[model samples]
Target: MITTNIPKLRQFYKIKAILFLSLIISTSSCAQLLQIVEQTPLSDLKLSQLDISNGLKGALDKGVEKQVTKLTAIDGFLQNELVKIVLPEELQIIDTKLRQIGLSSLADEGIKVLNRAAEDAVKEATPIFTDAIKNLTFSDAKNILMGNNTAATTYLESSTSTALYSKFNPVIQNSFEKVGATKVWSNIISKYNKIPFVKKVNPNLTDYTTRKTMDGVFKMIAVEELSIRTTLNSRSTPILKKVFALQDNR
Candidate 1:
């Protein structure tokens, strides 16, 4: 009985082989499917790289918008303790003496003027920072994304420090004049010197504020960088999510 159906059995086996070959051909020839497989590693790398670059750029932009811009505003530095300019080391004694003699308001005004000078100086920061961001190479971008929490800040400092100093110094000098910081300090110091027992103190406040304001700007940038690198919630955009997701896996 089995021998009588041998030809039919042969036909069934042939059909099965045909189906298997067809499946292989379809799988191999499907462009979309094959493309997906080909992109597995490359797409991941590209996506991760892009996310990191965008995240860093976003953080810097936000810092400039939120923190730096405020510092450039009228009372930005005067109001914020974190970046407020204080009397220089040599002038601290004069400040203390002024405050002690019922001249607290005068002393406070002196302090405010220093901060105001800083605020005025910060108006020049965006261009320097933008140049730094624009110059970021692919290697720098990768390092910033995958390196430590302050990687982007470090890159900024390295890339922009010399240029920033060159840029900030003049602006700070001008700001000192524009905000009347020079006159305010002169008044405060004059009052202090007029006190019977006190020696005169005149310090280069413009230089001090310039350096301090630069430090403040960098400090704010570092804060934003750390937030994005350490806090999951800081990855606000889709690219940030995907890039940081891969980072989490690693």
Candidate 2:
């Protein structure tokens, strides 16, 4: 090996180290500059309201499929309080009076039958709700997503109330017949009338039960909508998660 100057060699190493450090600093500075140029302000990035509305509509559709369909099944409304059908206004007084006179079991049966009729009738609700969802406009979705706890429900009622009533009425009539609601009420009223000192009670249970059942169905849907809106864990489905994530961002 040829003899080399130790001092020169040391100087050369020092220069190399300086050049390496300079290159690293320059690269780091360039990276920061690029980042500053490319970064976007969060406030400047606006989400599409239409997209948010679509997400809400999708969430509502999922809720109907998951929760509302269960109510149409046999004993569904009778068992589920959140969607349980109660006696209509005209029948409610009669039902209460009957229970007060120790006809509690009979009153209970009457209540059950009313719910049963609702359960039978709610088979019509799925198709009606489905149709309503199909007809939902962008504005409807936007308002619903940005609305209160019952916003989605209000939207549904506004758009589909008339059509749903038309569809539900005939089905409720048939359901009354099928579940013996009419017969039960007739018997209950007849028995109450026969009781000494009891006033006559002739309630139009069909109409009452129909309206109550419809209200119950809407109540259940609203419950589901509120749950998904407020509870992070309730967004269980993938679609629900993705859709609600959008809502959360808003």
Candidate 3:
């Protein structure tokens, strides 16, 4: 009589299950490998160090020309809500108190003058930014290109903030004087100080305005840098397209 061996039958089924699992795992792994291979094409593998460096420089130059130029123009900071200089924390209470007391016009003028000072001071930034961009090395280019969208702007800010602050502070101080912001703010603060039973404020306007002006400059550049990194059409030049393309793969 023919009889089935229970142990042999169990071992054969277990082996079949193991083989099926192995097949599934191998297929999934191959699919993942194929995806990785497709993401990084062979064409970009030959991109040279100099090409990447120049491409990053070109992108920054375009960003500076487009965005920083706007900051230097009349009403650039005042009109642009993105980078407009608002009152510091110490001054906001003064603004609110004045507006509540029917001194809204004065509050408005106080804010307007701060933005005007920023617009004037940002005019000095383009040269500093250009010098920084020109000095970018290959290592910086590789790291920045592979980094997040605003990486280039962050690099520029870190490398140039100290010099920029030194350059912008005096200019911002002078701009406050030139644009009559000093007088306007003085009047606002004097009136606010005179209000009954309110805490007095005598914040340093020069330091505040200088820092805000630099912040606006970097913010605008970041906007452009992000656009170039994310938006396909914003890469206006050939070098930008080629270098940033490598970043796209990552």
Candidate 4:
């Protein structure tokens, strides 16, 4: 019933083809966002060096704040399998011995107080860690942002471990005393020592627990950093979202 104009129909199809091509280019641009960043000259990067540095620092600070607070919570370290402080190798046999002697409850208390001391000591970490992160150099930031998922965490650990040891050691020692960990462990060791033909042992629990607590803290920070790098939901801040997006498509 209708006669189609071939010329007008050809024009309409040409317009449609042009629009489809534009759409394809736009989609390609989105898909190549990260590739473009990688290929972009360093001087032409959209984000400034300061922006990159500050963004990395901000991410680390958030991770430390969140995970450290969780570490300080009740049952945080004790209940968490990842960072749970268990008796050292020499003491594992002692735990078995205590259970064999039907004093499992006492053994339980000893272990509980150790984790409690770590939890209590972790409250001191935020201030020290904050200072360290705030002082990140521009070089540090660029390397970390471009490095592996846990690169920021690795930087924090390497930069702050010795200082954190000094900071955490005395606190853990005081925490052990405050929470009766020293007393409980003393009882445990005394009872174990009383067992005939057992080798005598005296361990520096302060050093041991401090090292373990720092390891746990770093471990948790690494987890948070990796989550932020790989999981969109973990990017809670604007900068975190934007900065981590570079690595997202990679």
Candidate 5:
């Protein structure tokens, strides 16, 4: 063309520049929208399709098998600070007084025997806990997965605590007798009872130890469940990996 109108040419290029910029912006926005849509369906598909219930049960079984099973062995409770049974509140003073009076060895024996009985009684829990996990419902599993770190353990406690207490109480009583805790505590209590200025104490050790032992078991299981959920390294099973991935992304 004859000498181009310089200003008009400049204006024309500016217009093209604006149009090109707008097209790029539009393309970027469309890509973002497409990504969002693609991700939404994938997430929905994962939640709706995955068999999380069995995976959750499997996780619990692993906890019981690996952690709880250890509590059944000799010195398991005594040696493990995490699950060690200590003196109950009513008996704490008794423990102190017995020690003060040069009966420290007896006091120590009494404490050891309590843990021993707990180790013995814990054997009964594995079967009951297995049965409870086997009966875990999908509703429970989903809520637990989305719940707080200890939610699974809280559910287990709520579902199993009462029945376990009833089952464990009797065994704890028997275990106390078998492990010689009954007689050992009898001696400790007798010695403490004879101490001057001490209030006479007759605690229901069977009930106390039963409750403490259950608490230790639940606490240990919660630790394992938390590890499996939050730490990718602790996902020892494929189901644990797949199921916990939901929590990870959420």
Candidate 6:
């Protein structure tokens, strides 16, 4: 400027010089990084799409095998506090009232039968889950690979809930008959209904047990998935190691 102050002009030039140097340094750094990446071998990077898909399926299958199998065993639900099927809210009142009336043994059997039905129904779960895992797409693998610890379990639930329910409901219904739950609960409910001034109650035990069993299946699956995601020893396979390494980087 024709009448620019000397101090102001010097300050402006100094600021401009600093910005020019910063731009040059940033550009150089980016270029250096790009060159390094380009020279790096693919083996040092993430795995192929097919490898990732197999790895994800493997983890899901492992979860189904380990956790679901446990649920299928005798006393699986009855013994395991984590996935045990307890009485619903309305039934809890019945249990308390029955126990107060010196029918504690009968009440206990009622509860045990519910868990038995769930355990029986869980016997049908492994195949359904294995089929769902086999259908895992590459896109699904990519998303599940980058998702949180339970994301694969969440995906399995969403994909298999309908099929599992259809498969489990009838099995639980039959199991109730097979395991004498229907008789035990019938006696318990009859006794509860006869209690003085109590509200008469009729609940759908089959639907209730089916839902609880499904919840247990998914919960167990999530436990294994979390273990695999967090514990290196739990990976258990080379592909699992490589696929999850991508997640570790992310």
Best by lDDT: 6
Clashing pairs in 2: none
Per-residue lDDT of candidate 2, residues 129-190 (tens digit): 87788878866775676578788888877777787778778887887788787788788989
What is candidate 3's TM-score against the reference? 0.81
Best-to-worst order by lDDT is: 6, 3, 4, 5, 2, 1
Candidate 4 vs 6: which has more TM-score: 6
- lDDT scores in order: 0.75, 0.75, 0.87, 0.85, 0.84, 0.90
Clashing pairs in 6: none
**What's the residue-level lDDT of 58 in candidate 1?**
71
Better of 4 and 6 by lDDT: 6
The global Cα lDDT (0 to 1) of model 1 is 0.75
List, residue by residue over 1-250, the lDDT tens digit for candidate 6.
4686999989999999999989977878977876555434324765666888999999999999988999988999999999888888867899899999999999889989999999999889888888899999987987898898889999999999999999999999999999999999889889999999999987779999999999999999999999999999999999999888877877
RMSD of each: 10.8, 13.4, 7.2, 9.9, 8.3, 6.5
TM-scores for the candidates: 0.75, 0.73, 0.81, 0.81, 0.80, 0.83
**lDDT of candidate 3 at residue 208, scale 0 to 100:** 86
For residue 53, model 6's alpha carbon misses the true position, in angstroms, by: 0.3
Q: Mark the 10 consecutive residues where model 1 has the least summed lDDT.
A: 41-50
lDDT of 1 by residue, 1-250 (tens): 3356889989999999999989987877777676566447537566644555766677666656666777777878777777777876777898789878889998888788778777776777788889778766655766666677777788888877788788788887887778777788788878888999777666777667778888888887787767766788877777766665655655
Which regions in candidate 4 have their CA more than 4 angstroms from the true location?
1-45
Candidate 4 vs 5: which has more TM-score: 4
